[model samples]
Target: MSELIIGVLGLQGAVSEHIKQIEATHCKGIIVKKPEQLHDIDGLILPGGESTTMRKLIDRYGFLEPLKQFSLQQKPIFGTCAGMVLVAKDLTDSDDVHLKLMDVRVKRNAFGRQKESFEATLQIKGFESPYTAVFIRAPYIETAGDQVAVLATYENKIVAAKQDHILVSAFHPELTSDTRFMKLFVDMVKKSKEIAAY
Candidate 1:
């Protein structure tokens, strides 16, 4: 009967936009920089930001192991853009892997450089219509594990995917005005709670 409280990893990036999206969903969104805060959140979001810098901060703040544990606990997690790269298990041509939670192989800046940033209407699974996806120096999934479900694709490239409690997008959903992806994350949180209750 308690209200849902979602946390956004506040190491860097568009944290406020995600908080606003969570607020619009009628759930609380808090910035979590410390590991202790994870205990209070029903779901967590890793927002779009510089992957390398965020990784360093996460290590400095001692959030790496805790976040890996959070993902292992089956709590809902939504990763956007660089966030997606952070969560991916495999990073092509790089030895640095952060959370390594989702079973996916990602290519950093898969869409070329910053000038190649573009937008597209993505036909995401479980959604009735397409979503306006904003790709900014995005990292797309080159390959995924058997457990990962492809959600949205752009030009035959994997742009979105889900595996168990983890959801990820190569594009920035928060950048767009639409809140469907945020809603889906909230709904995932509710469903996870319901399952836990049973």
Candidate 2:
């Protein structure tokens, strides 16, 4: 087994799906339900779900401050759907206590509600061909800073992006059978380990 350890924030959302992807990559995928759990992780994943409910859980579990600090440290993290919103610098389009990691502004429910969920073949940056993206009430990064690079786009909108070790996907890449995104994340974990050793 690989030494890379990934933490999937299990506060709420599609934790199982992300776990499946992480496991498929031959790395350890741990469900992080507590603030202490964040300490041992080499990388972290914030899954998709109701943003409001996720906030409540983060606050109720007293993880509000710790998670925020963790992201600020530039640890390798990938956020999907609502998770993307939380990790962003701010979501002026919506009202919520976001983790505020990336310098992107997210517009919540950009495609409507649950019924607005969709599937589209996206042209991801590093990927060779188009990827089947599953978006469930996803958000769109309205304003990305210069450091942020667009990883994937759908219908001329930025759906997937990365900034240093932090990645955010408006669509749920975990829901798809393709493991490219997860592989990229695993690669990121390895790179993070190498850099930390220096």
> TM-score winner among the candidates?
1
How big is the positional error of residue 51 in model 1, measured in Å on the Cα after superposition? 0.6
lDDT of 2: 0.86
Candidate of highest lDDT = 1
User: How many steric overlaps are in each model, in order?
Assistant: 0, 0
Per-residue lDDT for 1-198 in model 1, tens only?
Answer: 589999999999999999998998899999998999999999999999999999999989999989988877899999999899899899996988888899999999888775468888889999998789888988889999999999989889999999999999998878888999999889999999888788
**Candidate 2 local lDDT, 155-194, one digit each (tens):** 6778999999898899888998999998998898898888
Model 2, C-alpha of 190: deviation from truth (Å): 0.9
What is the TM-score (0 to 1) of candidate 1? 0.96
Against the hidden true structure, what lDDT does model 1 obtain?
0.91
Any runs in candidate 1 off by more than 4 Å, and if so which? none
